[model samples]
Target: MSRVPFYLLVGVLLVAGIAVTIYRHVAFEVPWVPGEQRQVWEVEAQVNFIAEGESAKVNLALPSNQEGFRILTENTGSSGFGLSFLDDDKGRRAQWATREAKGSQQLYYSVQLLVAPNAAQPRVEPPPPDQDVSWARPYDTAAKEVIDQAYRRSSDAFTFSRELARAFSGDRQDENARLLLTQFDRPTLLVKLLNQAGVSARKIHGLLLEDGRRRQSLTTWIQVFDADNDWVIINPTSGEQGRPDNLLLWEAGDQAALEVQGGRDSKVTFSMLQHNEPASVAVRNQLANDTLLNFSIHSLPLEEQSLFKTILLIPIGALVVVLLRVLIGIKTSGTFMPVLIALAFIQTTLFTGLAGFLLVVAVGLVIRNYLSYLNLLLVARVSAVIITVIAIISIFSVVAYRMGLNAGLTITFFPMIILSWTIERMSILWEEEGPKEVLIQGGGSLLTAVLAYLAMNNPWIRHITFNFLGVQLILMAFILLLGNYTGYRLLELRRFKPITED
Candidate 1:
């Protein structure tokens, strides 16, 4: 059979295998909400001491019986506190008392309550605006000082307002609100200043649904309770001064600390212990019971998993490179140079990394050519080239450091051995085949590297390799087929045209 048809059939079979693998391992899930669900009850207690030698009262706010749950019992204790339990149908409420303290005291207690089928009835409190208290007031007083300093140093009222708006509401560009929130370095500082301004604010930390990465720093904002408008959000860091963002409002004042604390004591302990189980556990049993299957896959022998993952792709990439070289008549220094370069490209990414490799290789070649004039032996010449390459990298690192580009550090991962070998091969090719042949081979090597990078990085190829072990069979079939390809390459088409005419 003609080599063309043989290789073509092999490619087709390999593709088919990949398709089958994807189809078999696909996961499907039904979308359904559970009928029975656990609901969270928020219970908050605040103990404020007037800094005097007197009894401190704890204010407990319970969602009224209209909301559910009845007040079971109330009690007082000598732990320097009194407790009052109020229960309506919806949930239970606890009010505890404390003695005069130097600083404001916060007490958190929680109770597990049964969920009622009916909707919760609302509880009335000191209106929405009154509930907007600064949650971070006790954390640091310097946070307030920072804002005051920023406001004072601001150029004008307009500038101050803009800074404040950006700092508080994140709308520094707004002319009106910018003056209100100024120079605060952090959201926490802005919140403290807003609290001093009689605007309720707190530091809120939570994932912004827009993105999943947890913020390195706290996303601090102020929540103000306006009698008419309810709770509004203010981002002090958004603008110039702590200007408000159109009086942004939140449903629960953005005080997640208060909400989490409302559930239980200041410290809650949860422990899970299982004992008297078999000490000798099978790997398969552990794998089967593993909650996170993706991570459990790594527990398999590293060599087995690594080989299983990359073995299929290696053959596919090699086949593609070989086909390009043999059939397409592309030139390269060695059979595997392009493959190794492609593997290197995996680390460096497409454009920048490839460019870096090429640049390094070219420089190394120039140095190798210079060293050739000294009549160095083959081994000594290669060692010199390697040393020169390392020296070049060290110089590049120093320059990059001086330039303050941290990415320069990635150059350490570049394959110096590959570059040295390529330089020597290209030099030899240059001498024997001349520049034209050298160029052809060089171009081919680069082209193969590019192709290999694309094939290796293909999402479908990666997905199949990772999900199924059957992909190796497909790769094997391709390898077998490619091994037999004996047709004239595309580059040889013109050279062989005269023979076909006969």
Candidate 2:
């Protein structure tokens, strides 16, 4: 067949594939009306009551800031004695009693409150009395040095806050936050620890939202105001307990409350079922009905909604591989080798998986090259190379296991035939055009593989491929455009530069 006809046929097939994918993913009927708005406030309570048989008053404090929420109505079950809502000077209160049960009886209630637009204050228990008594700050010279290194690297409030939070938490949880903390001072860690122990603390961000210009970036530490000590400014992230004038307090709370919103609206519904059966059995039964409410795109603008729908374009990656091979004269061992490799990289991550793949390929190539000295026929030579590649992979797995490289398992996904064919091509080039030519071609193939891996594994690409059906149409258009490019490639242009000069 003529190269033109072959290219045309491949282009037609690619256009068809893109069309189907777009129809499957991108095309969606978004309503003219705005998206729905949903706000969820998850409240969990753990109550402990200590009684010595006398009718003692039990007081539970509610959040003081009553700006946005209102207790609409409350329903009481038969298990509790008397319930009363008390209004306190600082915050709201709810009072209830229990009839003397010999052992311990627990009561649970969920209060449904209307959510307001503004922020809500998180409720926190008062700190122990000993918290006010300042003891000599504990000494840890190593930790102090680490903190200094962190501060020197980062001066941003977010960085300082993250570091301070990490140091205070003793680097137990919050891996992302810990990464941020490793750049600051010991005082930051101590302050973060104090905040975690029920003291109000935070790293505040200051910016000129109105002016659109750079504003003063200051890190001020402020303690929460209590009955004894007024709000004290302490630089915890700085490793200094005493106040620093550079720190600014935007707002103070026991703990930070984060509220995420989007331009488009969304809502989530939750239902709970309780049975008299054993807790474990009930949990098992509930697992069957468990549904996850994913609200990722609820807040995006309408113009961006179409972008969110392009997730169906994953199959286009296959078309891209095919086009690269037939139209662009790229040589891959197997028909679907590049696509399969790309998909594998998607699962294993590009950098780590590509490194493992290259390592395996290198080892396989070495073995194949050594075996070439045996002077076997083409089929036998290819087969022997495959076996050698497999054996090399097995050894790699063993070594990886001993060294604790978990990524070693990805070697199984390496196409044996592809490796064998690559070795054969490289050997042919080595004999004909020399090692330089072989290396150049090998480098080109590896570069294309890396590009394919990156394009296929991109988050935006995945999102478009999985979400929207119309993206396939866009892909079809791209394929059609690339199909008409009859001009020489950038490499071909260089090769024909002498002729062009004439």
Candidate 3:
């Protein structure tokens, strides 16, 4: 192709490759890099009730827009009931009704949570706008004494809140704490004290977001204003300040998350399934909400996906070879031979693969030198070397098996014919260019192969290549760009330095 067309093609490939990666990363939340962790949780709130004699109506509270998480999708499963959702001052509620009598009725509200980037930030909104925190006698007098003491010890609203939380948790042995704990639970007392102390405080019910939790009830905590007029979160149970990591605020005010009407017996429980996925995959999968994801390797069968994982990494190995040869001035036995060898290394593992390769080549080199004296034909000479290589491999395998090393079994995949050819070339080089040059070129080839293997086997590299096929186009574009270069290499610079100086 002409230079213009060639560069244009490379440019197109690079642009398209990058565009697809960005789109998938932003829109689908597919992680472009490997090893990033994201948590996607599937939560279910089940409302089961017994209905007899007449019809029944069930009103169950449903989770809606809350901080720390985003609801990707929601679903309901009810056998024989009409369902509708209503949003009012109380909270988001799901109402289910049936006209006829029934034995038992079950309803489910399920949500898939996509953890937001700011999920760790305290989910605190401005508290109710009012000021009726005056207290009643004796208890009022006791509350004033406790708040005044705690306030005197605290420097700011945050510290004051923590101090009160600490006192309520009973970690501190004091008369005030004893009286408060005896009167009410930590949650109720803390809110009452904070409101009485002129800080906007409210009792909020939340869930401790976790995996595999079943029949869990809401955890109660107190939200109050801090020194900066910003809301601060305090755990009544732990007596620690700030929102707990992975806490999802479920409801606020006095009403419970579930309220039942027109039903005799009512109960609500939660079931959660936690999934740990790579940041990108988890985000994308949660957003897609479909089993078969578009343009994702996840849609492929397990076997196919595994196969593609290795197959996609070849281009990366090839790129490593290109950089070593073109930019660094490395010499090798043959073009792409080390790449193929490195591929074998991937299977047999680096150490065993290298040891096996060197053993076969060393043994073959010795035998080929002996054959050289006989003046055998080129084809016959290569055939003898090939046979000798197999024998060496078989002997090594048997020895390794006896020695209790299982890695020796993978030597069969080492491309014996390539070893034979490498041995032949090295022998010729030793005879013509001398042993020193042979060693230099052979060592360079091994170094290149090891480098390529390292790049190919990287977790991030493997992930990107297999997960994002567009990355291969980017690699192709890069290789094409390198192909057009005619400048001196990094290693060549040293060899030519004296020439320029002179």
Q: How large is the C-alpha RMSD of every model relative to the true structure?
A: 21.8, 22.8, 10.0
- Please give the clash total of every predicted structure, in order: 63, 43, 2
| Residue pairs in clash, model 3 | 30-280, 31-280
Q: All candidates' TM-scores?
A: 0.43, 0.39, 0.59
- All candidates' lDDT scores? 0.52, 0.47, 0.80
RMSD of 3: 10.0
Q: Which scores greater on TM-score, model 2 or model 3?
A: 3
Candidate 1 TM-score over all chains jointly: 0.43
lDDT of 1 by residue, 1-502 (tens): 4668776777787887766555433311100121223322222223223324455544333323222221122222325566676555423445565554334344544322222223233433322223343434333344444355557756543344334545334332333223323433456555545555444444433212111222222244544443433343445455432323211111222433222222223321111111221111211122122233222233468688766555456766787787787678787778887777776676667775676777777888788779879998999999998898899888877887799976666677667788778888898887787889878888888899889889987866765465554566687786686566788789888987898999
Q: By descending TM-score, how would the candidates be arranged?
A: 3, 1, 2
lDDT accuracy of residue 69 in candidate 1 = 26
Identify the leading candidate in terms of TM-score: 3
- Which lDDT value does model 2 have at 227? 42
Question: How well does model 2 score by local distance difference test?
Answer: 0.47
Of models 1 and 2, which has the larger lDDT?
1
* Model 3: lDDT to the true structure: 0.80
Tell me how candidate 1 scores on lDDT: 0.52
